[model samples]
Structure formats: C-alpha cells, structure tokens
Target: MAWLFSLSAECGTQTQAELFLAYFQKLSWTLQDGKTITTVPEVMEDNDGNWWCMVVPQGLSENSVKSDEDTPQMREIGNLLYASLWNAPDFRYALLGIEVDLFRTLSELLEDTTIGEQPSNFAGLVLAESIWDLINRPETFQIFKPGYVWIPYPD
Candidate 1:
C-alpha cells in the first residue's frame, strides 16, 4: 500500500499555497521524483479548486506498497510540516481559512518513535494547541479525518 499524508487547507488561493510551499521548503524535507530524492514537494491545484500538498515516497504507487520502511517516517514528517505552516508570520494575514485536516494511512507506524516521533508529533500538536491558545473564538480548524489520500490524476 502506498503510504501518503495529505494536508488540505481552505485557503482557496495559489498565493497561500505558494507561501505554504515556501515555508515547507525551508524545512529541508526530502522530496522524491521517480527514484530521485528532492528538497521540494510537488504542489498543484486540483479541478475542484483545492490546493494539495502531498508527500509521496518513491517506489510506492497510488494503492500499492513497494516499501514499508519509510512509511511511518514520511507520515510523521508530513504531519509536522503541515502543522508548521500555521506558525509562519504571514499565515494569520494571508486570508487563508483556518480549516485544515490531516489524513494518513499508517496508524501502526505512528506508534514508533525511532525517528524522533515524539518531537515531530509534539511540535505539530504544540502548533495546533497554539491556534486555540492565541484565539479565543470557537474551533474553526481541525486535523481530524484519517485514511484519506489525495492522489494526483495523470493528464
């Protein structure tokens, strides 16, 4: 099974997506193109006008697993990077909506902390908690809804 994590934000603007991509690039995560590992994630807009930020490991297809060694690590890293966007200074003023959700398929892998799992999840949770801490309004953002992957369709 292909291991994937998707972060969907209702910002509805390519500008916001670009900003998020910039922030994500600064973190220096390893992105993969075919068998090559890159430093930037591939970002694009879907037909429904939603921007998708995806992390797809090499050797894995849309619905098949080619390797399991890196699935957990990828999911955790994806989660961390997804949450860190909210910490950007421009984030609050970007006119981006606050509704975000994290979808993943490796629940079992999340239990392993070999690759700094606690810190990753904790950092993400801290950012998430800060959302509620700084704002006194009702909850408008959420990271719920699991097991959903956004696969890009080939043209």
Candidate 2:
C-alpha cells in the first residue's frame, strides 16, 4: 500500500523542480472523475543540485497522516505523478517501495524489455513487478541501499 511517497526529481534546472512541486500546489489537479487529488510535498533538497521531496496526503511523513482507507487514493495519485515524469526525456522515476527511491530515464527503463511500451503504474503494478524487475538487475542496488546496485541514468 502506498501511504507516502518519496518523489525526487532530476530536472534541467531548479525552476523545473519548483514548477513540478508548484504544479501540485495549484487549486487544480483533477482526475478523470472530476475529483481533485491533493498532495503536500515536503521538499528535502533544494539547495543542492538535485531536488527531493516526500509526498503526504496532508502532513509530513513522520505524522503518518495517511490511513488504510487512504491508500487507494494515494496510490492512484502517486501513479499519475510518477508517470508524469515521462513528459520530458530527462524526466525519469522509480516507483520504489516506501523505504526507497531512484531516478531513471524513460529510455533506460524500457531497455531490454520484451514489451517496448513503458510499464504503466496504473494501480501499483510497479510495487510488485517493477520493483522486482529493478532489483533483479545486480546493478540497481547501489543507488538505494549502500553497497547495493546503481544503474546510472544519463543526466
């Protein structure tokens, strides 16, 4: 279940990252149902070259503002936000488990796959299949857990 999300971005500029965060803060962000999803993004990195943030339905991560009933909505919202990165060639993301996060180019992610299309995270398919597909590669661990793997994506 997706209670919270650590969504980090590697945009061409800090403004892009800010715009990304700002996109969520707008009074809009509606879904197909004409309903809006709200996410309060807690930025972790802004001063640095990279941008990192934690997304919660309302409060910060430690507050655990999300509940079991909230998972479905969060999952859906997370899926939209996750896939939105594909809008730019430089944009990439890993829909990681609650404890981890990584950035990957859209091209890099589709590499060596039998199916050429980008795997949709429509409803958390990423949690099981995507994560497994990623971890299976011996080189992906270093980016997450220390001494693990790292599939370096082009900046």
Candidate 3:
C-alpha cells in the first residue's frame, strides 16, 4: 500500500496524478445486469509505470476497451496496436505504451497467459479463471482491489 503512493511520487507527474485521483474520487456505481464487478473505472498508468486515477465510465472493462470500437478505418489503424508482451521481441516498447495510456500490444497480452491462445500453465489458467471469477463475484475483496502493480524500469 505504501508502495502505491511512494512509487507514484518517485516516478509520476504530480499534476497528472492529482487530476486522475480527482476523477477517481467521483465515480458513482450501481450493480448492472447482475454481472460480477470487481473493476473500478479510474486507473491509468503513465509511461513511467506509475499508476494514476483517471475517470473512465463504469461501463468500461479490459475487454470492452480492448475491443476495436472505432470506425473501420480507425479500427484497421488500431489493429496495428496488436502485439504481445511476453512473446514479442519488443516488450519494452509495449511497456512504454502502457505507461502512456495507449492500447496494449498483443505481445504484451501474451504476458497474461490467461487471455492468450492455449495458455501453457496453471498461472495462465489461474488468471483466466480470475477474469470469470471477477465477473461472477464482482463485490468480492479477492477481486476488486485497486489497480496497482509494479513494473520495473526498463533496463
């Protein structure tokens, strides 16, 4: 928990962090359609890997936001956003995009084996299992913690 703020202070833009925090403080929620709901709609990471709170709609989810929702041309352009973190040679660049509020590359998605094709181990299976678990039991503490995970500075 201390790491959450300490890292934010050491690595983040204060103004941007504050702006996002203000936004996160304002969300209003209701249980919709009885889906599981552990997600909060107000976290973003800077290119520096510091987490900030940005107000996204409660309706947004990783799946929803990750989808190609733009016009066909835009979607096509966005498809270039494809790449994975674990499998790509350029995981560093993908990490940079994550820091900048950009779409994560598929190569990066490969990091979370749970979401990728034919995950090879229990870890990946566990992650995939958690996704469904969150949907089914949104209010569970096991699911709805704030989004704060550390990514080391690139070597």
lDDT (Cα, tens digit) per residue for candidate 3, span 9-113: 111344555543453344333333342222232445656464443222233233233433322322221222221112211112221211233333223433443
* Candidate 3, residue 111: how far the Cα is off, in Å: 28
User: Whose TM-score is higher: candidate 1's or candidate 3's?
Assistant: 1
User: What tens digits encode model 2's per-residue C-alpha lDDT throughout 1-155?
Assistant: 33444454433345655665665454235665566656665444433345544344333234242456545554555556555543322322334334333344334444535222322321122222344355354322224232222232222
**Arranged by TM-score, best first:** 2, 1, 3
Q: What is the lDDT of every predicted structure here?
A: 0.36, 0.41, 0.28
Clashing pairs in 2: 139-150, 140-149, 141-148, 141-149, 142-148, 142-149
TM-score of every model versus the real structure: 0.37, 0.40, 0.21
lDDT of 1 by residue, 1-155 (tens): 33343333322356866765665555543444333322343456655565544333233243223466656545544444444554642322111111223222122223334323223232232112333333332233334223211111112
Q: Which candidate, 1 or 2, would have the higher TM-score against the true structure?
A: 2
- Name the regions of candidate 1 deviating beyond 4 angstroms: 1-10, 29-39, 55-65, 88-155
Lowest lDDT block of 10, candidate 3: 1-10
C-alpha-based local distance difference test score of model 1: 0.36
Ranking by lDDT: 2, 1, 3
State the displacement of the C-alpha of residue 121, model 1, in Å, after optimal TM-score superposition. Answer: 19
Better of 2 and 3 by lDDT: 2
